[model samples]
Target: MIAARILDPDSKLATTRWWSTTTLPDILGVNDADEDDLYDAMDWLLQRQSHIEKKLAARHLTEGGMALYDLSSSYFEGTTCPLAALGHNRDGKKGKLQVNYGLLTDDRGRPVSVSVFKGNTGDPKTLMPQVRKVKDDFGIKTVVLVGDRGMISQKQIDEIKGVDGLDWITALKTDAIRKLADDQGPLQLGLFDERNLFEFTHPDFPGERLVACRNPELRKLRAYKRKSLLEATSLELTKVRAMVGRGKLAGKDKIGVRVGKVIDKYKVAKHFVLNIKDHHFDFHIDTEKVAAEAALDGIYVLRTSLAEERISTEDIVRNYKNLSQVERAFRSMKTMDLKVRPIHHRLENRVRAHIFLCMLAYYVEWHMREAWRPVLFCDEDQARKKTRDPVAPATRSKTALEKVHSKTLADGSTVHSFQTLLKQLSTIVRNRCRVPTDGPNAPIFDVVTTPTVEQQRAYGLLETIEV
Candidate 1:
């Protein structure tokens, strides 16, 4: 199954059967296994998933290590499975039944465990079960839990604080930030001009430190986005107003619904004040509200239980930002790479088994990418350089252009991406030859293909020899 994920990520069960019979046997040096074998193996793994997760945690996690948690949803086709229901669809598949799953990863972005939950499960509710698993199932002590704002609640924080030797690192929500910035708040625009970060404490959040960070480039980007959205909203409002002036629209309820849509379309309803009377409709932008929101354009607050002396503010920001690693893992499991979607399994266990298989496949791919960095395009080395401009997001070339297709290694040999290198290695094939029959059950001879130097070097990085 791992090999199928690496070689044919977008494959379904039928395609996997073909691969096992044809391509996989040559590479793995084993007899062809049927689709039943695959299905049985998945069921067996699902039955022992808990034990497997504990073993993984024992091998990869340690005391004081960071455990990052996040949730993602995938849509299902039918309603036969009990896990499938209408809920928050992260995949943008509205009106479709979906299943939600939580993924827990180590600080290095390697997946440690995953849990399947009902589609209607809330993000904050998923954290406690994972917390229990980390403490009770994995038997890990003194580990910090890292998550986004959606995954951590005030109640959850209180619960985590009660646990001995467990800490949390999370960001504050927008409303919480606004409350912190009330009268004589610690966050001020001027403080950002002198330095990007400031440290403070809040009465409500006792025994915790807050780190406020500002990005000038992010401020400019937000300002531009706000202006564009406001303009679009204004244009929409003008159209509605003209309709009212021309006597095309009437009735208070009708105008209210129409104006509501205009404001909702651009998501700037809070910035606009709508007035509706009999046969009259008008709207105006609340400049004070707009300015107040603009003041917080680039500001973000990170709350943590760790003391300033234990971990620097910069390191705190870096660790919080690493939540993007979990996001990247989701992207890989979704459309970005692994395409673990459009689930057709009807049984609940089968659905869970399918997602589990995808997670396991991703685990193998994660290690493979790290081991084959010399022949693959790794983003870690270039991440710092890419973040030099805070406003612009980093981008990599989707298609290799002729000018920058290959990279030159220290030995002066050209290397390609892992996918491209795999394609190069696929040229080596095994041939079967018939030898003269010495006895009744004579063994047949097999001739192995000679691997090119490039294939040899690529395999060498993985600490394996070409077959």
Candidate 2:
């Protein structure tokens, strides 16, 4: 199943037909497996999920280490599955049922375990169980949890504080940051004159530190996007006003509803002032509101329970930023490689097992990418990443940039993406050969194609990996 997902993702029915064309069935010792067999296998895997997760946790997680947790949802195809419901749709599949799941990974973003939840489950609702899973099930005592603001809200933080041996690093929501930047608040624009990152504290968050960051580039980008959205919203609202003027649109209720749709579509209602009457409709940008919002653009504050002695301020920000790695894992599972979305499984356990299978496949792919970094277009100087500015946007190293511009390694060999490299290796195949005259009575032998130098190089890198 992992091989099928990594190689080419499709429906299970297609997988049954697909595997026969490859050596996966032979390699996995499931040559005669049918669709029923695959479904039954998924059920079997789901039964052992807890045991499997414990083993992975033991391998990847350590006491006092950071565990990255994030929740994402995938749209489901059928409504029969109990886990599927209309919830926060991250995939932008309107009017589609989805199943929410949270991924837990170690500090380096190596996936340790995943838990599937009902589609309607709130993000914070999934946190405490994982905290228990790490401390109770995985037997890790003194661990730090890193999650996004939505996943670790103030309510969740209060709950986490009650638990011993558990620490957390998460950012404040936009509203919270806005409060911090208020006239008397600690987060002042002047604080960033010397450095982009500044650490301060508030009495509200006792025994915690807040690291405020300001990225000028991000600020500019946000300003541009806001201007664009405001313009777009204005353009749409103008059409509505024109309709009201031409008598095509009338009535106070109708004008308000039309204006509501326009503001909601762009989600910049706060920046607009609307006036509507029985026969008149007009809207204008509230410049003051826009400037207030623009003041907070590209400014975010990270909150962490860990102390400066245990972890530095920069490291705390970096750990919070590591949540992007989990995001990358989600991207790979959902669309890039695994194609875990639009699930058709009706059984809840089947859905859980399918997601687990995709996670396991990602585990393998992550290792392969790490091992093949020298040959692929991945940066080799990873140590630089650890030492670089945690708040600044990541930039590629000179060596990595060279590979990008030249499209080759030092040996002048072509650099390939992870997918293309795998495709290249797939060309090496095994065939059963026998002379025509001796085919009836002779013993057949497998003839494997000799790998090319490039294939050998790739294989050599992977030889050290222990599956």
Candidate 3:
């Protein structure tokens, strides 16, 4: 089933029967497992997830290696599963019941372990369990837990400090960054023009070092986004103001509600000050507030327990940015490549089993992506270029590579994405041909479809030999 998931990601278990009997039996050299077998196997695997995850960590993770952690949610269609509940839906299905799950990955973004929690679990609360799992179950000593700011609160930080040989790397929230800037005086943009990173310490967060980073490109993008939203919001607000002046909107509450809709639509409510009274409504752009925010537009602060002498600022930024790797994994698990939802499982254990199966499938897909990079649009090499600091975010490189790879090939042929390539592989079929009543035996044997040149090339890239 895991292999079926990787080979045909869009397929469900019932659809695997034909592929398994026709093709997989020849490749894997076994009788086709039925849907029930797959479900039972999933249940068995879920029961041993703890042991399996430990073995995975022992095999791939090293002591003191950085563990990147993050949380994602998937919606459930039915309400039968005990684990499904209303919560913060990362999948954007706000009214749907969902389950929150956290994934732990190694420094290179190989997933080591995953845990399912109730749908409403807060991101910060998910950290300690994962940290303990890394320390106690995986037996990884001197580990650095890297996550986004939402994963680590001040209380979580204090809890992490109590753990021996356990360190953390996470970014500060916008509020914390503002307070840091306030305490240190206004952050001079000229300093960032010379160098993008600066190190500082504050009494509020003792024993932790802060790395301030500025990206000029991010600054320009943020400024542009803010200006565009402000203009659009102003237009909407102006219409409301006209309505109020013309006496179309009489009550203060009605005018406030109209203004609120515009503010919410643009999501620039904080940048404007709105005043509403009986038969009067007006809004003024908060220039001072906007300026303050603009000053920190491209700036971000990373907080880590690693000592300054032990790690370079560039390395800190690079490691912190690897959180994007886990995020990428989540994207792969969700709608991007592997659609792990509209989950059909209604039992609690079955839900867990389904998620665990997807994780295992992704474990294989991750390696396949690396092996098949020559034929795919992957930037693993470009991302590791040593000519300059790789500390900058890799999002741009990934997007550029996606565009480059999706274009026509050098031979004027269409390029195949990873998913499309898999679809091509699925075309290779095994046929059961019956010999015409030879003697009395009436023997039958299976014949595999001859591989196309493109399929052969894909198999060669993946180092998979056709049976």
Candidate 4:
């Protein structure tokens, strides 16, 4: 039953109890530690996964590729685990008990490893463990950890430099990186036939440099965004401020609301957020709006530790900034109806088991995305049009073992029994073990399944796998 549970999408085995009838079914041994029991199987699985980890270790993931890192938090109903806490929530579902999850993924979005942070813990601390896990578990020599501004700071930069080989590309907050670009007034390294991406190296920091990609499109986008925000704020403030002459708004607090609220027209206004030591944890717009109707078009600056030689500075800046793929994966994990929410069985052990299974579900979903994303629809309406319907869960697992059953080839009629089919298909291969001089390998085995007739019909769809 546990073996079946491991393969099932829902982790639920067949519902039946042969022991209730005092029938030990065809097994020769007496019951001691029931192999089919969930607890016993879970213990066996834990030990086996540990063995697999120790057996083989040498770049289980691809090299010379970027690793995306992102964090997410999920809610819990009751106090069953130690990690659950009340902290700042990104999903706006804050004040609810939650547990944080940090994920590391290869370039194509396969999960390399994961670490759980306490709900109350800061996101920045998860970086080191993510970096170390990739090096230790997968032997990935060259790594570029891609994260947003939330996951990095000056201390993180110092840590990256101290390490012999680790590169990071994070979005530079307005405060830390604004000076680099601000000092050079509207700096252009001379426009190219296309936009010229510049590679900036720091002399003080050895083996540490920055990639500044000049994205004309991005510049245009930012300019439009800033203009739109300025206009919107001005429009809002105008509506409120115009009421000031009518004596609607009064006192210093009201004046602060009108004066402070408006993005004054002199310069392009942008909110400056510094996420560093003694982090200034508020949104303060940087602009002096003494007059009305101001438009400022500007180029935003992003910094990365990637050397100029490996990737063109422009590509580095562009690629590193697009780490939303990892964030999307986390979003799917939390939003999916698999109910990954923590529901403990009054025991922390069960809680951990539940979380582990949820992680496994996420791993499977990630693999599915890697395979089928190209064929999937960009919109819900588009998806419903193709393939008639969603693929059933057992189609793949079942179709692989269709030969297990035999049909009734009788003189008058033909019939088949479903129980007989499973009986014929129910089998397992003994664990095959072969040790090599280079390294230990995991125990390998084979499994068989008998699909329902409906599953056999949908075999062609599930058979498709992307290269």
Candidate 5:
């Protein structure tokens, strides 16, 4: 059986409390394992997971709603972790310990489910499964999957639409995105404006829709960036195109000697952003010449199938940007760095258990982030300058966050209920009170005092965790 235990050093039952100390006294008892170690504890957890898995229903809501989305990964230093053989390490740390995970969440950033893959998993490849998992497992009846362009593909879009209740909003590359700008045809100047809605809907997926959303602010920003990019691309194309046949400038950098091919390839691609005003068939270029290069930048297209009955475009677009909330959850997972590399365990069971802990830890971390979000990244200094009050903004800010409601898990205590109890528990610290003859180490007395408001809140959250 795999071993497991409560490994947190600060916990009351910690036998290896000193293990986290970076400079250890010596390498003693390094390889020891007992019945009460992590592996055994893992067995119990797996049983719990299996029990949870059994409860997952088949043919669950493959159709529906609020599919929050993002990806995460871990790296490995050794070849032991099967998911570690690198491919598209998003973190750019491929040569180290790596594993990647993609997840879907609800409006509150509560994960619906997760899928793990090798660290090299491409972000685009992750889209379909993430959408499907929540649809199938969580009884999600109304799906509104939102992601950045890296997760968009026509095939992936088609897959989501293939399901009845799903919708999405994904960013598209600017060049490819330009198709939606003026409805691609003779629009009388007054036709598209503030109260008017322009829609392009597909017959096969009738609910599939694209609406152009460009505020003056968004447009001005895009215009400025596009001009800068076109200028830069032209300069690069000029320098590269200038180097003709077998010349030192060309061969000095090991450039392939296809003088005709390089210039021809380069000239056509630059036209996506640098097109003369009358270039008519530019939409076709997206499928052909400009696809790959356009993707190199983050220009994204938003596509959604959510029926207009449920939500409007502005809210959909705004909520979709909140997908970054899921992205941040994944970022925090990697940062805890619980030495989650090498993944030395070879048994499939251990790997599953190990991942489960990371998942559990992910829940806790996400929960905490939601709790402090109102104040964490907020600039208290500027906020104070604005003469603004902070309390009401917690509920009012566009930021949406909530932890999965939990009573005591295992023992089943409600979080609020236990929070009250833990505030009563006290911690004792040693302090030196020297009278002339005392030894170098002074023994401290138990200091039972009132809990600070913050400490009471902290302990209250922990009290909900059943042993």
Candidate 6:
């Protein structure tokens, strides 16, 4: 099941047909197994999920270490699964039912465990159970949890505060950060002039450290995006105004409805002011609001319970930004690498099992990526990631850029993406042969194709890792 997901992801029925053409049937000793057998195996896998997750947690996690947690929802294809419910659709599949699942990973973003929740479950509501699982199931005590602002809101942080030996690192929400930059707030814009990062404290958050960072590049990008959105919204509003002027669109209700669509489409309603009267409509950019928003463009505040003596400000920001790793995992699972969406399972447990299987498959892929970095397009100089300025946007190493431009490794081997590398490996085949002079009952022999130099290099690299 895992091999099918890793090599060529598909539904159980499709997987059965696909794997039959490979050597997996003979190698894994499931030559006669059908789709039913695979489903039964999923059932069996679900029963042992806790045991498997516990083993994973033991391997990657440690006491007083940091763990990253995040939740994402995938759209469901069928209506029968009870876990599927209508709620926030991250997959952009409007009106579709989805199931939310929380992923817990080590500080480096190696997936440790996954828990499924109803689609309607809020992000903050999923935090407590994972905290309990890490502490109770995984036996990791005194751990620092890292989550995004949405996941570790004030209410969730309040709950986590009561738990002994539990701490967290998360950014302040936009509103919270805005309040910090208010006239009377402790945060100062001048602090960032000398350096992109600075630390400060406020009475509102006692005994917790706040790390403020401003990325010039991020600030400029946000400014550009906001300008584009404002212009687009204005253009649409101008069309509506023109319609109202030409008598093509009249009535206050009609004009208001048309204006609302433009505002919602661009989502820049806050930066615009509108006036709609009978057969008249006019709108203007709210410059004050736009300037206020742009002032905090590249700025963000990270809040953490750990003291400076425990973890540095740079490390805190880097750890919070590592949530991108979890996002990458979700992209791979939902899109192509695993095909975890469009779930065919009607039973709730079956759906859970399917997601768990994909998580396990990703766990293997993560290790493969780390081991195959020498030959892949991935950057090999990971040590710099920890030492570089966390506030600045990440840049690829010089060696990595050369590999991308040259399309080959230092030894003249070609570079490959993870998917294309797998395709290259699939060319090796095992053949059955018999002597022509022998009788019909003659013994058959197996001959496996010799791997190419590059394929052999890949195999040799993977041999050193124990995924």
Task: Identify the leading candidate in terms of TM-score.
Answer: 6
Q: What are the per-model numbers of colliding residue pairs?
A: 0, 0, 0, 1, 34, 0
| Candidate 2 residue lDDT tens string, 1-467 | 88889998998899999987888899888989999999988888888889988999989898899999999999998889999999998998999999999999998889999999999999999999999999999999899999999999999999889899999999999988988899999999887889999899999889999999988889999999999999999999999999999999999999999899988999999999899999999888999989999998889999999988999988988889889899999999999999999799998889999999999999988888889999889799989867999988899999999999999998989899999999999999999877667447876689989999899999999887875
Look at candidate 3 and tell me the lDDT of residue 238: 94
Cα RMSD to native, each candidate? 4.1, 1.3, 3.3, 14.5, 11.0, 1.1
Could you give candidate 6's per-residue lDDT for residues 22-130 as a string of tens digits? 9989998999999999999999999999999999999998888988999999998889899999988898999999999999988777998999999999999999999
lDDT of each: 0.80, 0.92, 0.81, 0.51, 0.49, 0.92
Q: Compute the lDDT for candidate 1.
A: 0.80
- Looking at candidate 3, the ten consecutive residues that score lowest on lDDT are 385-394
Model 4's C-alpha root-mean-square deviation from the true structure amounts to 14.5
Q: Who is ahead in TM-score, 3 or 5?
A: 3
How do all models score by TM-score? 0.88, 0.98, 0.90, 0.59, 0.59, 0.98
lDDT pick, better of 1 and 6: 6
Residue 421, candidate 2: Cα error in Å is 0.7
Q: State, as a TM-score between 0 and 1, how close model 4 is to the true structure.
A: 0.59
TM-score, candidate 2, is 0.98
Model 5 per-residue lDDT tens digits across residues 1-467: 11111122122123344443312213344445343575677777777863443233222123444566777666554667666666665566736756766766666565535667766778888887665555555556666677776777666776665676666777656655544333553222233345232445544335566654433444456556755655554555455444432233434223333323433544444444321121111111233333344322222335676668876665655566667667666654454322333355555566666666655655554554445332233221323322322111222222212212322222332333222332233242223344455786665543335665655556565555533
Model 5 ranges off by over 4 Å: 1-36, 50-64, 94-97, 124-132, 139-142, 173-175, 182-206, 215-301, 336-352, 373-467
> Candidate 1 or 6, higher TM-score?
6
Error of 5 at 290 (Å): 12
Model 1 stretches with alpha carbons more than 4 Å out:
10-12, 26-32, 379-415, 432-448, 464-467
Give the per-residue lDDT digits (tens) of candidate 3, residues 202-279: 787888888899887888999999999999999989998998899899798888888888888889889999889988
Off by over 4 Å in 6: none
- Clash pairs (backbone) in predicted model 6: none
